[model samples]
Target: MAVTKRRTRRSKEEARALILEAAETLLRKGGPAAVTMRAVAGNLGITDAAVSHHFGTRQELLEALLHQGGRRLKDELNAALKEWRETKPSIQSLVDVIADVYADGAYSELALQLHLSGWRDRGSGLLNSVVDELHAMRTKAFAAGGRKRPSIQETRFAVGMMHQTLALDPLFGEDFRRSAGISSADKPSIKQRKEMWGAMLRAILEG
Candidate 1:
């Protein structure tokens, strides 16, 4: 007779994380439509009721995933800022960090789906720390060079534009580029576009 293998039990947090990971995998594999409760449960070898118990509904799961992405973006950006403080300021580095998070297109697609479903960010100010740090960095730089410092409004506008562009690029960048006369074969790669944005932002900040 063969012995049965026992399934390891997980804590609530662990199970929730695994469920989110499964949902994210589905999202990456088939975009937002793929990330359903059934699919997520199947991916994790869990029952629909189990997933519901953790997240209540698919909408809540998607919201949690988005928040997780935001937290990752914040952490990576904070790390980049720390490095910049140790060395010279590199706007391109910062741009690349944001681009990396949105490069896969999964997060962008998820965000669009949630917005279409009437989900809003609720002004959680997830990026408020980032905005504050960036403004402080710019202020220090300008003071060091004896130049006029950028107002907080200007900094906020610049950050908003940069973020919006990256967030939407995965969804619309190619189409927009083609519409602007760039051929599919001739259009810049995502990395190149990010670099261009970095240069443009640097000019705007340093001008």
Candidate 2:
């Protein structure tokens, strides 16, 4: 006679989290095309029905992934901003922080795919808080110097431009640079580009 072992059940939240974790792993390993229901279930030692039960469809899962990524970016940016406030507020540090997030290429590719699939942010405005913080900082600095303060709209536009450039850089920066005869070997270096963007943004804020 053999004794049977029973498996413990996971709570709903736990199951969903595990599923998302597995899906993200798959997304990072391959691209968005690799994050299938079957693949995620296989990674978690579960069934396809389990994933579908939690996320109804692949599109929903991808949307959740984007939301999770946005939350993570928000947290990281907030932490960096706190550190910047404690020390000197360098625009280069801020640009470096954002550039680091998209350096791996996974998030940028996923965002591109989702956008191509007609997926919209749906008013999430993930970077809105970041824009507000930057605006406040610039306003305070300008007032202290007796200079004209930049409008909130101007701050928003500047931040948006930085965000868009960083997001797209991981996907096409090399090619774009190569086309411009910048060399395919990162001759000017990514850090240089980030520094340039930072300087340009600072000028925008000050102007």
In candidate 2, what residue range of length 10 has the lowest lDDT sum? Answer: 182-191
Model 2, 15-123: lDDT tens digits are 8899989988998999899999999999888899989999999999988987888888989888987897789777788889888988888989999999999988876
**Residue 98 error for model 1, in Å?**
0.4
lDDT for 200 in candidate 1 is: 85
Q: Count backbone clashes in candidate 1.
A: 0
TM per candidate comes to 0.91, 0.92
Error of 1 at 56 (Å): 0.9
lDDT of 1 by residue, 33-151 (tens): 89899999998888999999999988999999998888888899889888988998677988899988899899999999999999999855556765787788788989999998779
Judge candidate 1 against the unseen true structure and give its global Cα lDDT, from 0 to 1.
Answer: 0.87
lDDT for residue 206 in candidate 2, whole number 0-100: 76
Least well predicted 10-residue stretch by lDDT in candidate 1? 122-131
Q: Look at candidate 2 and give me any clashing residue pairs.
A: none
